[model samples]
Target: MNIIDKALNIFAPGIAAKREQARTEVVRQQAVRKVTNSLIGGVGSNGRGYGKHGASTTKSSMLFWKTPVGDADTDIHQNVPKLRERARDLHMGSDIVAAAHKGLRTNIVGTGLRLNPAFDASYLGLTKEHAETLRSSIQREWALWADTTKCDAAGLNDFYELQGLAFISTLMSGDVFALMPSKPRPWSVYDLKVNLIEADRCATPPDKVNIDRERIQSGVEVDADGMVVAYHFSNRHPGAGGYSLSGSNEWVRVNKYGKRTGRVNVLHLFEAERPGQRRGIPVIAPIIESLKQLSQYTNAELAAAVITSMYTVFITTPADDEGGTPFDGVGMDDEDLDGAEDVPGATGDEIKLGQGAIMRTDPGEDVKFADPTRPNPNYEAFVRAMLKQIAAALELPYEILTKQFTSSYSASRGALLEAWKMYRMRRAWLSKTFCQPIYEEWFVEAVSKGRIDAPGIFDDPAIFAAYTKAEWHGPSQGLLDPTKEVQAAVMRMDNNLSTGTRETAEINGGSWEDNVQQRAYEQTRLKKLGLVQAAPTVVTPSEPSNEGDEDNDDEEGGEQN
Candidate 1:
C-alpha cells in the first residue's frame, strides 16, 4: 500500500474508481451469463438441467423424454399402429394377455346378445294388442339379421360372434368398423349386410386422397367440428399380397352415411379417450413393459427349474500315464455295468458322466455329484407382487387375472365386486358405442321395410329414437351363495328397492317379459293337459292378545276364588 498506491495516485487520480468499476463490470457480466445460461438451459429446481433439445442431466432420462405430450387423437395417430402390433404379439405370446382377453370376452359378450325392446305404450298411444303385434313383428324381423348365415358373407352365424369379434378387435386394434351394405339376401328381412373391417386396411391417406381439403388424418376424415365424416380404407389389407392394375395402393372412400339419404352406413366402434379422439389406444399399452419383463422372468424361472432337476456330476482323477483318462481300466464289455456301453464316450481327457454309469477312477480320484438349488426362494413373492401391479394397471383383480383365489371369502368377494365395476363400465361403453348404434340402424331398416309397424318414424326423430330404445342382455353374474342371494333379491323386489325385470335380468340374463310370457304358455299347456299346479303356500304370523285383558282375566279368577 505504500509505494504502489502513492505512484497510482500521482499517475492516475481515477485509478481506484477504474479498478472498482472493472470489478463491478465483471460481476455484472457473470450475473448476465448466469441468467442467459438459465434461459438457454432450463435449470430445474432440483439442480438438474435440460438442454435445448430436452436432453436432461437427470439419470432417468429416456428416449421418449423429448416426446411432446399430445392430445388423445394425436397420440393415437402417432402410436396406435405400433401399440396394436405389440398388443397382438402379447395376446399371442403371453398367457396372461390371452387370459385377460378371454375373460373380457366371456364376461362381456357371454353366450349371445339378447334384445329387450322397451317401446313406450302410452307415448305411441298403442293398444295392448297392437303393441304385442309390433313387438312380435320386430322380434321376427330381428331374427333374420341375428342369424349368422344371413348376416354377413363371412358366415359369422350370429350377432354373438360379431360382438365377440368386435370386442376382441377393439381391444387388440384401436378401432373396428362395421359396414352396413345393401345386398339382397333371401334370409334377411332387409337387404342389410355387416362386414367387419380391420384397422390395418385403414392406413394413412393415399396421395390422391387430398389430405388437406379432406382433412384426413390417419385414415379418418374429420369435419370442422372434429366429427368423423368418412373413412378411407385400402381396398385390400396392407399386409395382404395383391396387385392393383393401377400400380398404386387402391383406396376406397366410405362415408359415415349414405350419400343420397344421409342414413348411417358405417359404424366405428372404439372408446374415445379424449373429446375429439379419432381412434383408440390399445388397453394393453400401459402394461406392455411390465408384461415383457414378466414373460422373461417366467421363462427364466422355468429354465432354472429344469436345470435344477438334472443331476450334475463332477469327476477328479489322479495323474496317470494315459493322460488323465478316468475310464482307463474300465472294461468296455464289463457285465457289472450292463448299460455303461449306452453312455457315449468323451474325446481325449474329457470325462462324460451319465446316470447309472460307473467310472473307474485312479485310486485317489474323487467323483462328487452336484446338488444344484435353483428357482430363487423369493420368486413366488416377487411374481405375486408384480402380478398385483399388472392387474391394477389393467383394472383387473389379481385373483381374477391369475385365476388363483388364495384369499378369504370376504377378500375374494371384495376383489370381484371391485373388478366387476370396471367390467360393467367397459360393458356399458361397448353397448353404447357398438350395440346400441347397430340396433338403432336395424330398427330404422325394419321400420322402413314395413316389417315392423311404427307411426311417425321418419317424420319425428324423437319417436324414431323411442322406437329404437332397447336393452342388451349378456351373461348373469351368478351367485356365490344362491339361497341367500335369491332371498335378498326377492326382499329387494318386495320392498320396491328393485324390480322383477332387473332381478330376472341380473340372475338369468332373461327378459322379465319373456319369462312371464313363457310362464303363461306353460300354464296354458298344463291346463290343457288337465294337470293342477301347486299353489304357493303363504304363512301369516299370529296376533298377540291385549295385556289389559290378561290382567282382567287374572283379577276375575282371583275374585271368584
Candidate 2:
C-alpha cells in the first residue's frame, strides 16, 4: 500500500472500509446484470412488484410471512380431519351453527327436490304425446323407487328425506358419499338402494403404503392427470369406527366409474372451490374462528350475567355485647338451619331470593341487600352484530339465519330473497352432484331391466343426457304478500312471461298438470252433485287492472315476533 494510503487507513479506518464496500457492491451488480442478460427471456416485469400486494415481503411486519404455492389438495389434506371435526362439533354444540345447516337443508331440499321430467322429443324423434307418455311412465317408476321401504339402503328415510340429510351433512361434514349398492327387496321391483357413507369413512387406510404411483389423499385416489379415479371407503367410520376388521384393516376401493359400463360407482359429493381440490371445504370453514370467538364471548357474557343476577347476603353478627361479624366466618350447612331452602346457584351459603323472601338472621344482625346489576343493555346489539358477520360468511341473511324477522316488509322480503339466492345455488349443486347422478343410474338400470322402453340410450350419450336431463324443484319461496305476489304472477302470465305450470311450481311447489287433473275431477264431482256454477269471467290483458291501495300497511308491515 502507498505510504499516504496506509496513514489514511490508520487515521480514517471507517472511511476506507466504506470505500471498499461500495466497490464490492458495484462488482456484485455487474455479475447480476451479466447473468440476467444471458437469459432468452428477461426477468418478470419490474420483478412483478413482489414486495407488495397478495404475497408480500416488504418492511411491514404483516407482510413478512410467505405462503407456499402448493397445489390445493396438498395444502388441504392434512387439515381435513380438524376442519371436519370442528364443523361437526359446532353443529352439535352451537344452536346457531346447527340452525345454519338446518336452514340450508330446509330451503334447499325441503321434502325433496321433485323431479320435473323433461324428455327431449326433437333428438329422440318422438311425438309430443309419446314424450308425455314416457314422462308419465318414468314418474310412476320413480315413485316406486322413492318409497322409504325401497330407496334407502337402510330403509331409514325416503329419497326426499335422504336429500335433506345428505345436503345438510355435506355442509356440516365438508362432503358426503353415496354408495349405490343394490340389494333387492322381496316386494319392490327396483333393486337400486342408496347407502350414504360419512365423509370420515372415505379416506386413505391407516396401513396404506405407496404401492401404486397414484396419490391417495383424504380417501380420494387421483391419477397422474389429477383426475379422481376412485375413493377408498373404510367399512367403519374412521372418526368413530374402530380401525380393525378381524385383526386386519379393510377399505373398499370403489372406482369412480365401472370398468366396463363406465357408470359412476362411488358418488363423491362435494363442491370443489379450487382447481384440483379433491375434497370440499366445510361451508363454515371461513367463519370458524369468528364463530368460536363469538361463541366464547357469548358464553362469557351469559356467565357474567348469571353471576351478576345472583344476590348474596352478608350479615354482621353481634359479639356478646360488641358489634362483629356473624357465624364465626364459617358457612352453615342447610341441615343445621331450620326452614332453609336450598339456593339455585349458591354453594356453601344460603342465597335464596324468592319473592317476599324472609330471612331470619341471628339476633342483633342487620340485613344488607346485594345489588345484581346484570342483563347487559348492549347484549342484544352485540349478539346481533356477531350474527350478522356469521350470516354473511354463511351466505345467508341475518334475519333468515336468526329467524328474527322483526323488520319492515321490504327488509324482510329482501332478506328472504337474498337467502333464497344462496339456497337455490346450493340446491342446484346438490341436484347436479347428488340427485341427478343417482337418478341417471337408477334410470339406466330401469331401462336395462325393460321396466321402461328406450332406444339408442346406451349407444348415444346425447340421448342418454336428454332422457336423464331433469329439473329438480324443491320448496317454493313463500310469498310475503299473497295478494300482491299473486297479482304479479298473474300479470307476468298475462304478458306471456310465465306459464301456469311454472307459476304453480313457484307458488306452492305443485305440478300444474297434476293440479289441473285434480281440478277437473273435483269439478266433475261437483257437477254430478248438481252444484255447478257459471264459469268466472276471464280477465284479459286489455281489461283495466285494479291498483293496490296506497293506504294499506303492506309496505311497512312485517312478521311479528
Candidate 3:
C-alpha cells in the first residue's frame, strides 16, 4: 500500500468527526439564542413579553400606537394632491407621476428564509432532479407575490379587475416563506413577505353592528361625519362575528368570521367628496388606499405611516479655506498679515461650516471674516421639527425606547441632507476655486488662436469639450466628459429656474437691452396677474345682506317652526 493512501485512510474519520462537531455547536448556539431572546420565556433581550409575562423595552416589541379611527388630528396627513400641484408648479414631477412613468422598483426586505434543520435530511432525501423541480416551484410562487409593477392609469384599472385572483395569489405566496424556527442564538434573522391589495374590493354588510352609517349622497353610504367605509365580508364566523365598534369616533371595524377562522376588516377614511361638499377636494381621504386592502388577512393592522416632506435649503456665505485667504500663500505683502492681527485665525470648524456666515468685516474690506464657527441653528431646528412632525403623525413619540430604530432612520435622513448640502457646496467651491485657472488656460489658447477678443472661451463648447476630454498619453483613454463646461453652465441655468426667476436671459445669455426688456415683461406680467402693486378692480356687491331686517328674520322663524 502507498504511504499517502494509508495516511488518508487513518485521518479521514478524525476530520469528518470534527466537521460534524462544529456543525452541532452552531445549531446549539442558534437554539440557545432564539429561545432566550423569544418573547415568551428565557433570558437576555428575548424572554420578555406575553408568553413569558415579561415586557421588552425594544421598539420591535412595543405594540403599535392605535391610530385614531377617523381623520388624523393636527392636519398631519399630507395633502398629496396639493403637494403634487406645488411640485408641478415648480416644474418637478411627483413620486406618483415618476412611478407611473417608470417601472416599480424592487428591493431586499428583511432577511430571507432559512432551512429547517429537523426537516433537512428528509428534504434532501428527494432525488436531485426532483429537488431542482421543487426549487423552481418555490421561485415561481415567490415571483407571483414579490414582483410588482407601476403602470399607467389604464394598467392600474386592469389590475383592479383581477383583484380577486391577485388577493388569493398574495396569501398563498406568504405561506411559501417558512423559515427554520430558532430557540435561541447570537443572531436571528426576521423575514417578512408583504402582500399587496387593490383599493376597492369591499361591500357593506347587511346589519349595522354599532357602526354609524351615513348616507353621504344618493346610492352612496358612508360613516357619520363623512368617512368613506370599505369592508371585506365573509360568511365564516371569525371574519363576520366578534367584531364590534369601540366608540363613535372609532373607524376601524374588525369583522371576525369565528375563532381561528378568518379576519375581515375595513379601514375608513374621510370621503373625497359628497353632496353638500365641494367636488374634487381631497377632504381627508386616504391616500395609500391599497394598504388598507392588504390588512384583510394575517395579524396586520393599520397605522398611519407618516412621511414628512422637507427641502434642504442652502445658505451661501464666504469661503474660509486657508488657500483662499488673502495672505495664506497668495503672495500678499508681509505688512498685510501684521495689520490683520486683530482678526481671529480660521479654525477647522469655521472652514467646514463656511456657508451662511455673516461677513463681520468692513463694507469696503476685501478680506471678509466669515464666522464659520457658528452654524444656522434655525435651520437645525427646522430639520428637527420636520422629524418630530413625521413621528407625531405616525402616533409615535420621540423617546429613548425606540432609540436604535429612530437613530438609524433619523441618521439616514440627516445623511441625505448632509450629502445634498455637501454636493452643492463642493460644486460651488470647485467652481470658485478652479475658474480662474481654467479661464486663464482657455484665454491663453483663445488669444493664440485669435479668438480671445469677444471672450469666446466661455461661449465655445467645442474648445471646452476638447480641453475637458484631453488626457495624458497612454494606451487607454480617460472617461472624462469633454463638454464639461457647457454641461455645467446648463445645470446652473436649470438650478436658477428651479429656485428663482423664469427669465432665461437673467441667468444665461443676455445683452443690456435684453435684460431691460425681460425685466419690463416680467413686471407687466406680474401687474396683470395682480401680483404687483396694482389695485384689484372693485365690483358692486352681488346682493346686499339683510342685517337686522324683519323680512329675513320672519323667513328663518318660519323654517324653524
Candidate 4:
C-alpha cells in the first residue's frame, strides 16, 4: 500500500463528519430564531397570529366581542319575541321541559284559590261581634268575583287555575298581562272580570303618537319617573289570524287603570333579571345551549340502540347455485318479491323477518350474522351531569327537575328545603305583583258599593292600607315526617320562638283567625250533638325526695312491720 493513499482515506472520514455537524447547527439556529420571533410578535404557540391588543386569535374568541351591549331592556327588546317562540317550542318538544313546568305549577298553586282576610277589624271601627260578619261578607264577595263561572271567559276551574296558567305563560313568554274590566250583574255587588292577554297583544303602538313624550316602547308607556302610565294593546293579538303590516291593525291606548293613589290596575307578572330590565327573559334562555346539546345526545343514544337491535343475516350459496332459494325446497314466486312467505319445511303461518322466525338454509351454505354493539358506556353519566347543570340554571333541584330521588334522605330533604325557599320567594313576588293589585281594586269597589263596611275608606291612606291587608294561602308543603314536625312546632310555640298565628299560617297556608273560627264552629256542632272531645291534661312532675326523708320512711316502715 502507498503511504499517501492511506493518509487521504483516513482524512476523508473526518471531513465528512465536520460538514454534517455544521449543517445541523445551521438548522438549529433557524429553529431558535423562528421560536423567538413568534414569542416576541404575540403569536400563539399554535402558529396562529394574535388578535388585536393581544387577545385570542381563534374565531370563537373573536365572536364574543360582537355581542351587543346596552341597557338590559333595549338589548333584549328585539330578541324577546324570538326567544319566547324558541322557549315555547322547547317546552312543547321536550319531556323534561314539560315536566318542569308541571312540577312548578303543582308546587306553586295546588287545589284552589285561598286568600284569607287578615284585615284589622279594630282599626275599621268594628266591634268583635261585627268583625266576623264583615270578614265573612268580604270573603263571599271575593268568591263571587273569583269563581271561574263569573271571572274567566275561557272557563278555567277558578282563579287558582288562572294563576297557574299565568305562571306557565310567564315562563314560556317573557311576561303575561291581565286586564281587569268591569261588567254588569244584577245580583252581584260588583262585576269584576279578569281578562288574560297574551304578550303578543301588547306591542309598540303603531300610531307612534308623540313618541318623544310618551316614550312608548313594546306596548308599555312609561313616564319620566319610569312608571308605566298606559298600555297600547293591538285590537287583536298579533299572533291571531288576519294580522297584517298595513295601517289596518290599529292600537288601542288603554290608560293605565288604577286608583288615584298610584295603585296600578293592569297587572304585569314577570321576574326581572337586571336592575333596569323592563321586560323579562324566558327562564329557559340561559340554558338553551345545554338543552340543545342534551337533546342531541339523547337522540343519538336512541338511534344507536335502534341500530344495535337491527341484526343482519347473511346466507352464502354454492358458486353455481345463484338461482336456488336459500330455503331448501321453497321455489321463488313472482308474488313474494320481498321474500315474506312460508317456507316448505316451516309451519303454514307467514314468517316476518324481524319477528324471531327461524331461517332454513341449504345443507352446504354458511350463515353469518352481524351484531353491532352500541350506546356508549359514558352516555348515562354524561346525560346526568348535563341535567344537573340545566336544573341549576332553572333555579331548581336536580331531583325536582328529573323527579328521580336516588339520593340519601338528608340530601333529598335539603334539596327540597332549598327549592322551597326559591318557590316561596317567587310566590311572594307573584302575589305582590298580581294578586295584591287585584285585591286592592276589589276592596275599593266593595267599599264603594257598601258591600264591605269600612268607614273612612277613601279619606285616609292608613285606613286603605289596613283594610286592604290580606294573606294569600296556597297549597301546603306537607311535612316529610309529620310527627316530628308537629312536635317541633309545638315546642316552638311553647318556647315563644313562634306564635300560634304564625304556625297556623305556615302549616296549611290558612289564616289563624279563620282556623279559630272554624274550630269554634266545630265545637258548637259537637255540643249540639252531645259529643265531647276529651281535652288533653298536663301533669306536673313531683320534686325528688332527699336521702334523710328516705331513711325516715324506711324506719317508719320497720315500726309498722
Candidate 5:
C-alpha cells in the first residue's frame, strides 16, 4: 500500500492539471458551438426558419417533419414510375389537366415547329444572296424529309405531328426517348427516321454495373462527371400485358451518340430542374394534388346538381295504415316498384318523376321532397381560386389557362402577354431539346448523302454549327384585338425595334418575303388588267375644293335677286 500510494501522489498534480484543462476545452467548444449556431441559424425544429413559430415544438402548426438530405436522382428514381402513371391517369380524367395538355400542344407545337434555316452568312464567308440561296435549297430538302411518313420509324406520323405527340408525351411521362435509326426505304430518299418511346422503357438494367468511373441512374448511364454516356431501353414497354414478367426483362443498351460520327443516336428528352436530377418530374407534378381535389369537387357538384334536378320524394307510411299514395290513388304496387329504375345515387331506392306531376301523400303518411341544396354557391369561386393556384404552378395565367377572358381588354391583353412569355420560353426549349437535335441529325445525313449543300460541315465543328444555324417557327400567338395589336406591331417596326420579317413571322406566322412577293404579283396582275391601284387621297377640312359648287352659286344668286 505504501509503495503504490507513492506513485499516485507523484502523478496527482499532473492528472489534476490535465483534467482541468480538458474541462476548460469542453466548455470552450460548447460556447463556440452556441455562438456559431446563433450566427448561422439556431436549430430549426420543424420548418423553414429558426425564429418565431418555426422552432416551436409544441405548436400545432409546426409539424416537425425530419427530412434527411437526398440527391435528386435517388428521389426521382423511386417516384417517377408512380408519378408517371398518376399523371397519365389524371390527364385522361381531369378536365383541367387535359385542357392544360391541349393548350400546351397547341401553343408550343401548333401545326409544327417548322424549320427556318438561318445560315450564319458572316461565319460562312458568304454574301446575303448566296446564303439565302443555300438556305432555300436546304429548306426544300428538309421539307422532303420531314413532311413524309418516311421521317417516322413506324411509317406513320410525319415530323410535324411527331412534335406535338412528343411534347405531350414528355409532359405526360416526365421524360421520353427517341431513337434515330437509319432505314433505307425504296419510297424515300432520306434514311433518317425518328422513333419515340415512353419513359418506362428507359430503366436501369437488372445487373447493375456500378464501376468507380461509371454508374447507371435509373436508365441513364453517366460517367464520373455526371455526363450521360448511354441509355438502357427495353425491347417492349415495361408495362405491356403479359402473364409472365419475363417479357419485360430484356434490355437494350444504346450509346448516347455514335462513336464514329459523334452524331446523336438516342435523344433523351426531359426538363431537369435540379443540378443532379437524372430524370424529369412530370409537368403536372406540382398541381397533381390540387387538380385531383378540384376534379373530385367538380364531380361532386355536378352529381349533386343532377340529383337535385331529378324529382324524388320520400313517402313515409304510418304503422297502422298501409295504403295507396294520394296522387296515384293506388296502393304501392309490385309492378310499379319493379319497373321504376333506381335513383342515380347511393339511395338504393326506386324513384320516378313526371313532367308536371303533383304528389299528395296519404293523410297518415308524410311526404318530404328530396331537396339537396346543391349547385353550391361557392363552387365557381372555389374552383377559380384553385385554378389560379394551379395556373401559377403551370406558369400560365388563370384567364389564359381557363380561356375565360371576361376581364377588361387591358386585363385580357396583360394575361395574354404574360402567357405568351411562358409559351415562347417553352417553345424555345422544345425547339432545342426535341426539334433542333432531330434537325441536326437529319442534316448530317443530308450532307453525307449530298441532298443538302453544306460544304465543309463534315470537316469543322464550327462550320457545321454555322450551316445548321436555324430558327423554329411555331403557330402565332393569336391576336385578341387585331386592330390594336396590329398597330402596336406597326409602331414597333417603325421604331426599328422590330423588323418586317419578325413582325410578319410573329404576328401572323407568315414570311415577310412571301407576303411581299404575293403582293407584288397581285399588283402586276392589276396593272395588266388596266386596274392600277391608286394611292388613297386625303383632304383637310380647312382646305376648299378645286371646283366651286354650282348649286351654291345658284342659291346665292336667287337670294340676291
Candidate 6:
C-alpha cells in the first residue's frame, strides 16, 4: 500500500479512541465538578468558575468569581482538566461558538472564516475605498460629545460608560458584536475600538443650559420606541398549565394616523396564535391551587405538558391589530354584498366595497354586540396569561413578568413603556453575560495583529475563515488508525513471511519486504515535527533475468557430454 494509507492505519485508531474517551470523560468529570463546586464554591471542569447554581455545564451562564471570604482561600487551587464537558445544560455549545466565530471573522477580515487562503486573500485584497464603504455610518453624536467636553482621562472614562448605553441600544436590536474564546480576555480583537475624536468647538454652555441638557439627556427619550411583544404559552386548555409571558418586553413604536413617534422604531407582535400548539414548558405555580392540580403529574410529564400548552396559547391567540387595517365593514359593505353573486343583487354599480361582518363566531353561534368602543379585555387578559405561562416555563423571576406594548396603550407616545423597561433590564443582564470574558483575549489579539489602531468593527468573515483554516486545522494531525490487516498486500505478505514459505521470500518475489519499506516512508511523514527519524531501508529480492538459458538447459539434459 501507499505511504499515506500505511501511516493512517498506524495512527487513526489511537486518535479516535483518545478523542472519544476525552469527550465521555468531559461529561463525567463535569458531573463530578458540580458536586465539588457546590461544596467548595469553585468550578471543576475548566476551573473557570461554577456557573449560576453551581453547574459548569453552560459557558454563557457561567458564574463570575467573587473574592473568597475568610483565609482558607490559599488552599484552593485552580485546575484545567484536559477533558472538558462538550456541552452544558442550557449552555452555549460548539455551534454557538462557531456561529459567533463566523460572524466575528467576517466582520474583521471582510469575509467569512472558511479556513481557506484564497478566501482570505480575496477579502484582504479589497481596495481601501471599498473597505471603507462597507463600514456602517459613523455616528456623529460621539464626535460632538468629544468636542464639547474637555474631560480628562477619568472624565473620559465616565463618558465612555455613558456611550456604552448606545452599545446596549445596538445589542437589543439583536445585531450587536460579540466574540468567542471569551474567558481570560479583557477586550476582543474582533471588536472595533470606538474612538471619540475631539472636534473643534466653541465656548462652554452656561449653568442653566447645562442643567437643561442633563435633564434632557437623562429623560426616557433614548428608549426604543419599537417593541417586539412575544407571547409564550402552553398547550394546555387552562389551569396551572396555562401560563404565558411576554417575550418581547421591549420598545415598539407608536403611530398616530400613520405618523410615527417615540425613540424606538418598530412593533413586532409575535404570538402562538394556534390551538394545541406548545411554545414553552409550563411551570409549577407555588400557589395552593396550582400545586394541588400539579400533584397529578410528575415533573418530567408536567414539563412536557407545559411546553405543549404554551404552544397552544401561542397558536390560538388572535393576531395583534397593531398594523392591521381597520375592518369597519359590517354595515358599510351592505351595498357590495347586495350586488354580489352570493347575495341576490339589487344593483352592481351602487355596491360599496370594504370590510365584512364583525360578529364573534362560536360553535353554532354568532354573538353580535352593539358596542365596539373598547378592546375586549378578556382577550387582553388571555394574552397576559400566555406570557405568564412562558415565564413559568422558563422559571423566570416575578419581576420579569409578562408585559405588552400597544400603540393605543402608550397614548400615542409609544406602546412600549413596560417593554422598553424590560428591554433595558434584559440588555444589562445579557451584556454582563456576554462581555467580561471576551474583552481580555480580544485586547491581546488585537495588539498582536497591529489592529489596535484600527476602527471599531467586526472582523471580516472571509479573511477570518482563511486565517483559522491555516492556523487551526492546517497544523492539526488528521485522525488515524493502525491495524495489522490494513491492506491486501500487507496481509498476503504477513501470511507468506509467517509461514516461512519460499513463495514471496524467494529472490524473485519479496512483497512483504516491499511493504515494510512503504510503511517506513509513511512513518516519517506522520510523526510530529522533529519527532521522526530517517526511514530505514528494506531490501527486496531482485527479479530474475534470462542469461545463456538455452545453452545451459541443453547441456544439463545431455549429461555433461
What is the Cα root-mean-square deviation between model 4 and the actual structure? 14.5
Q: Candidate 4 residues 519-541, lDDT tens each? A: 89999998999998679554333
Q: lDDT: which is higher, 1 or 2? A: 2
lDDT by residue (tens digit), candidate 3, 416-529 = 343334333422332222222222333343344443232233456554333222111101111122233234445565667332222222233223334666878988998888
Segments in model 6 whose C-alpha atoms lie over 4 Å from true places: 1-407, 411-415, 453-561
Model 3: per-residue Cα lDDT at residue 506: 22
Number of clashing residue pairs, candidate 4: 1
- State the lDDT at 46 in candidate 5: 27
lDDT of 4: 0.72
Higher-TM-score candidate among 2 and 4?
Answer: 2
Task: Give the residue spans of candidate 5 off by over 4 A.
Answer: 1-41, 45-49, 53-59, 209-214, 243-248, 319-331, 334-339, 343-363, 536-561
Candidate 5 whole-model C-alpha lDDT, 0 to 1: 0.78
Better of 4 and 6 by TM-score: 4
Error of 4 at 434 (Å): 0.8
Clashing pairs in 1: 148-157, 148-158
State residue 133's C-alpha deviation in candidate 4, in Å: 2.8
In terms of lDDT, the poorest run of 10 residues in model 6 is 76-85
Instruction: Score every model by TM-score.
Output: 0.78, 0.83, 0.19, 0.74, 0.82, 0.17
What is candidate 4's CA lDDT for residue 385? 80
Name the regions of candidate 2 deviating beyond 4 angstroms: 1-70, 209-214, 244-248, 314-369, 537-561
